[model samples]
Target chain A: MQKHFITLLFTLSLTGLNFANAYEMETTFHGVLDLRATVTDSLTGNYTQGGYGKFALNDGESFTLAQAGGEIALNWDNGLSVHAVANAYKNNGDFKLGLTEGYIKYSGLPNASGYRWQSKLGVFYPKISLENNAYAWASKNTLNSSSLNTWIGEEIRVLGNEITLTRLGRINKDPFDLSLTVSAFVNNDPAGSMLSWHGWTISNRQTLYTEKIQLPYFKARMQGYDLYEQASSSDPFLEVDDRVGGHVRAEIKFHKKGAISAGYYNNNGKPYIVDNGQYAWKTRFTHIDLTWLLPQGIVLTSQLLHGDTLMQSPLKTDVVNNDYTNGYIALSKRIKAHRITSRIERFNVKDNDKTVGDNNTERGKAFTLNYTYRLSKPWFLSTEFTWIDSYRPGRMYTNQPINLTERQLAFAARYFY
Target chain B: MFNKLPIQIKFLFISFFIIFAPSFVANATNTLTVNVVDTNQKPLENMVVYVEPIGHKVTLKNTNTLEIGQANKAFIPYISVMQLGSKVKFNNQDNITHHIYSPVGDNKFSVKIRSGQEVIKNDFNEAGEVSMGCNIHDWMSGYMLIVDTPFFAKSDKNGNTEMVIDKSGQYKVVVWHPQMTDINNRITKTINLNSAMAVTMQLSKPMDEIPSQQNEDDFDFLSDY
Candidate 1:
C-alpha cells in the first residue's frame, strides 16, 4: 500500500511539473541539520532509557545528532504544487529513515459564499501545531516541542484528503477572516496506544514512519499476566480494525495580528478488535489553540488539549480507560534575528477504568527556556534547558515508585536552506 | 589685463560668449532642485519629481526597461517611477509563483510569473498611478507612476530630488508618490528656470496610510478552511 501511494504521488508530481514547463516552474528546497550536545540528570537514578516506558535516561552527557530533514516544494503557474519531506535520525536509539509527509495541493479555488476553497490530498500532518511553523515541522523557538505537540508528532498524521475554506478578510477590505478545515484519514489505527503506554513525554524526537518502537512495560505486563507475547515492537501505521476516521478544525483571524482556533479529532474504531499486533484505540480529543502578536515583536501562544482512549472486551468487563489532559503557555520575543522563548506545560494521564494492574497512571509538569541566535538567514545557534517533574506509580521495577525530577540542557547548531 | 582693457571690450566679450557660446555648446541645461517633505518635514523617499514643459514639446530620448522584482514575497521597490512608453518587466526572484496584475492603472493586465521564469514586458503608454497587486499573495502590493516627461526624480529618504532639465523655459514641476491622497490635485509649481536654483514643495495634506508589511506566517493558509 505504501509503495503504491509513493508511485501515485510521483506520477502526479511529474504530471504537474510537465504542465508547469508550458508556463513556469518555481521550486524550493529547504532543510536543516541540527547537531546538539546534551546533558541530562535524573533524580531517581532510573535513567530514562526505555522508549515509551521511559524508566531512566542514558544518565550522562553526550554529543548527539539530534535531527536532520528537508522538504522540497514545486509550484506551477496554474495553481498546482507538490510538497514532500524525509527525515533520518535516532530518537534515543530507535534509528530509522522515513518519509515524513507528502502531499499534492491545489490552491486555486474560486471565491464563493464570501470564502475561498482549497484542497490537499496526500499524507500530511494536520495544521494543529502553532509552534511547529518552521521547516520540516521543527519548532521555531526551542530544540524540543512541547509535550502535547511531541505526542502529536509521534502518532498523528492524516493519510488521506484535507479540504480548507478560507474567507480572506483584508482582501475583501474586511477586518477579519475565518477558516474551516476538514480531514478524512486512514492507516493510523495505532494512534492512541503510545499515549496510553507512556502517558506523555517531552522531547524533540519525531517517530519515523517505519521505525519499530519498543514498549517494555507492555511487554512486561503481558508476560507478568501470563498472556501470549503481543510483540515487542509497535508500528504506528498498521491497519487494524480497518476504518476511516477524521477531524474538523475552525479558525478565526483578526487581521494579520492574531488568531484563535478550535478542533475536534476522533478515530472511531473498535479497540477490542486487533489485527497484525495493532489495536484500534477508539480515541478522541478536543484541541484549542491561540496565537497573539503582542507589541515589540513579542508573541503569546497557548494550547489546551483533552482526550481519552479506551480498549476493552465485548462485555466491557476487562477494559483499560486512559484519560489524558495537557496544556501549555508560551511567550516568545524577537529582537531582529534573535528569538527567545519560554514555556510552561502540565500533563496528566489516569486509569479511569480502575482495572487491575493498570500501569498508565502518571502526572507531570515541565518548564523550558530557549534562546536562538541567527548568525545568518540560514544558520542558527540555539541553547535550551528543560526540566520535568513527575510521579509515576507504575515505575516500580525496584518495587518502589519514586517522584522524579529530570533536567536536560542542550546546545545545537542548525542550518536551514 | 581685462581691467586695464576698455569697458566696451569686456562687455563685448561677455556678450559674445553669452549669445554665440550657448548656441555652440548647447548649455540649455538647468538644475531643478526639489525638496519634498511631509507635514513633519521628514525627507520622504520614493517620491517622483518631474518637469512638464509648457507651450512646447520636450521629446524623451532615453527610454529603458524598468524591472519590478518580487523577492521575499514583496515588490523590491515598493514604489516605481516610469515615463510614458516605458517598458516594465516583472521578475519573480523568490522561490514561488507570483501572479501580478494592475487592477486600476494605465496598463490593466495580468500575468502569472513563476520562479526563474520571465514574463512578457508591459508597456505604460498612459500616464497614471498604476496600483499593482498579486493575485496569489493578498498582502503584496506595489505602484508604478507613469509620466510623459523623462525629467522626473523619485525623492530619496531625505526627501530631496534634483533633475537636470536640458531646456530653459516655462515648465511646470510636479511631484508624485504612492501614498499621495490627491492624485489630481498634485503639488505643482510653475517656474522660469533661467538658471540653476533650488525649489521646495510641501504636501498640502498628509500622506495616505502606507500598506502594512505583515509577516508571511500571518496568513499561512491560502483559503478559508
Candidate 2:
C-alpha cells in the first residue's frame, strides 16, 4: 500500500513540478520533498543499538545504519487532492495516502457564522499541534530518551473526520489569532491511549467529536509564538477505546527567547480498557514543556510528561507517577553547501508500572551530530556521528557504570525530482 | 429557526455575522476605512498586512532568506513575506556589520551580515508563522509567516494593496492587525471573487488604541512589532 501510494505521489509530484500547475507540463509544483538521514562514528565498543520494538534494546551492539523519506502533495482542479509519503527503509512509518485531506470545501460559510470561518468535510489534518508537528528537530524532544512503555494522551494520535470552522488572525500583524475546528468521525481504529507507548492501542470503533474552543494566539517579532486560551472537549462522537475525555494544552514564549508550553489532558478510563471491561479503568495525563532557544541556533528543549495509568489504582490508577524528563541541545550551521547539525539528548525516566526485565529507573544519553552537502542539483549526501548510553547506576564495565553506551557512524545519499 | 426577530435588531446585531460575513469585507467594496497607526497614528513602516481569502486555492512552501536591506541602523521593508520551504537574508547595506536573527520567528536562523553579506537559505518545512530577532541588537526585529495558502496578502502605506487570487474559488477573507479591536479577532469575512474582478476591500481599525512592541519580553513575540 505504501509503495503504491508513493508511486502515485512521486509521479504526480514530478509531473506537477515539470509542468508547474499549468498541467501543460508547465509544472506549477504544489508539493514537498523531505529526505533526511545521518551517519555517525563510534566512541564506545559495540554500544550503538536503537530501533523500535518490544525488544529493540538490542544486546547493545555497535553498527552503522541510515534512512530517508518524505512526502509530496498534489492538488487537482475539482477539489480532489492527494498526499503521499515515501521512505527509504521497510515499514519506516509515515507512508500512506488517503482522503484524510481530500474534499470539496467552500470558502464562504452560510454567513450566519462568524468572520474568518471556513472548513472541509472530506479529509484533513486536525487542529492539534504544539511544536509536535511544528519543527522537524523539535518533534523528537521526548523520543530521544523515553522508555519503551510510557503512554501519552495523544501519543501516536490521528483520526479521519469531517470538519468545519474558522481561520483567525493576520498572517503578519494580527495579535490575537484564533481557530475553531469541529469534526465528526466513525469506526476509527483504536490503538493508543494516554495509557500506552507509541504503537499501543485497542482496535476498530466508532465515535463523535464536537470540539469547540477559541484559541487566541500571538506572534511578535521579539517573541516567536505565544498561545493563551482554553478548549473544553474532544471530537463530538470520536471513539477512543470507546471512551471520551477532555483534552487541552497551552504555552507562552518568554522575553528571553525561551518558551514554556504546558497542557492538562484526560480520558474516560473506560473499564473496558486494558482489562477488556473486567476492570473499568479511567485515565488522565498532563504534559509540560519548556524550550529555551539559547544563542547560536542552539536549542535546549526539555519536557516533563506524567499521566495516569492502570485499569484501577488505589487512588487514581490513572495517576501519572511515571515522569519523563527530556533535555537536549540542537545546534546547526550552514556553511557553504554543507549544513551541520549537532544534537545530544539526555533522559531521566521513572515509572510506576514496572514491566519485565526493566529497572524502575534508568538514565540514558544519545549524542548525534551530522553534516550534509547538497552534492548536486537533485542530489545530496550526509554523514553523522552518534553515541547512545543506557546507564545502569551501580553495574560496571571496568570501573564505569555497567551502563551501556553504543557508538555508530552512518552515511546516506538522496535524489529529489 | 430565528427567521422572525425584529428586522432592525436582526440587521444591527443578530444577523450581522451572517449578513456581511460571506460577502462585504474591509476592501474598497465596504465603507470602513482602516488607518493603521502606531499608537501615534503615525503610519508604521514595515508592518505586514495579511488578507485571508474566504475560500480560495492557496499555495504553501518553505523559503529561507527574507532580504531586508540595512542602510542606516533600521531594517528596511521591515515587513516582508516569510514563505514555507525558505529562509530570510539580512544584508548589511550599511557600512558596519550587524549581528542579526530574530529570537523568535526566525529562531531557526541567525548570522552576522558584514556590510553587504547575506545567508544563502535555511529550512522551514512545516507550516505556520514565526518572528525573527537580532541577538546583537535587541531593538532590531522582524516578522516571518509560514502559510499553506497563497490567498493571503500584505498592505502598503495607505494600508492598501491589491490582493491577487490567481483564478476563481471560495475563500475565507479576513483583514487583520496586531492591534485590531477586541470586538473579535481582527476582521475576518468570507468572499468569492472571480479572476480579474479586482474587488475592493476597505479594511479599517478602531481609533484611540494601538498595540505596543515595548511590552515584549526582550525576545519572544506573541503579538506584533
Error of 1 at A211 (Å): 3.1
What lDDT score belongs to each candidate, Candidate 1 first? 0.73, 0.38
Candidate 1 lDDT (Cα, 0 to 1): 0.73
Candidate 2, residues A250-355, lDDT tens digits: the string is: 4444433555656554444452332211223344445666556566645555555455433323333332234444444555555556667666656654556533
Q: Chain B alone, model 2: TM-score? A: 0.56
Q: What is the interface RMSD of candidate 2, in Å?
A: 15.3
Output the chain A TM-score of model 1.
Answer: 0.91
lDDT tens digits by residue: candidate 2, B71-162: 55456654466555556566777654555543333335445566566655556666544444443343354555555554345665665445
Q: Residues A1-417, candidate 1: write the lDDT tens digits.
A: 467457858877777767876966777777778888878775333222343323223456767667788788777766777888787765345456778888888775334234567788877887788877677787777888898998888788767788888876544446677889999987677787777766677776666665555553543346554113244555666567768888899998875578899999887767777665556677889999998888876788999999988776544443567889999999998787778999999999888775545577889999999998988767889999988888777665444444777788888997776
Which residue segments of model 2 deviate by more than 4 Å?
Answer: A1-88, A91-155, A160-240, A245-284, A287-304, A311-321, A327-329, A353-360, A376-380, A392-402, A414-417, B1-225
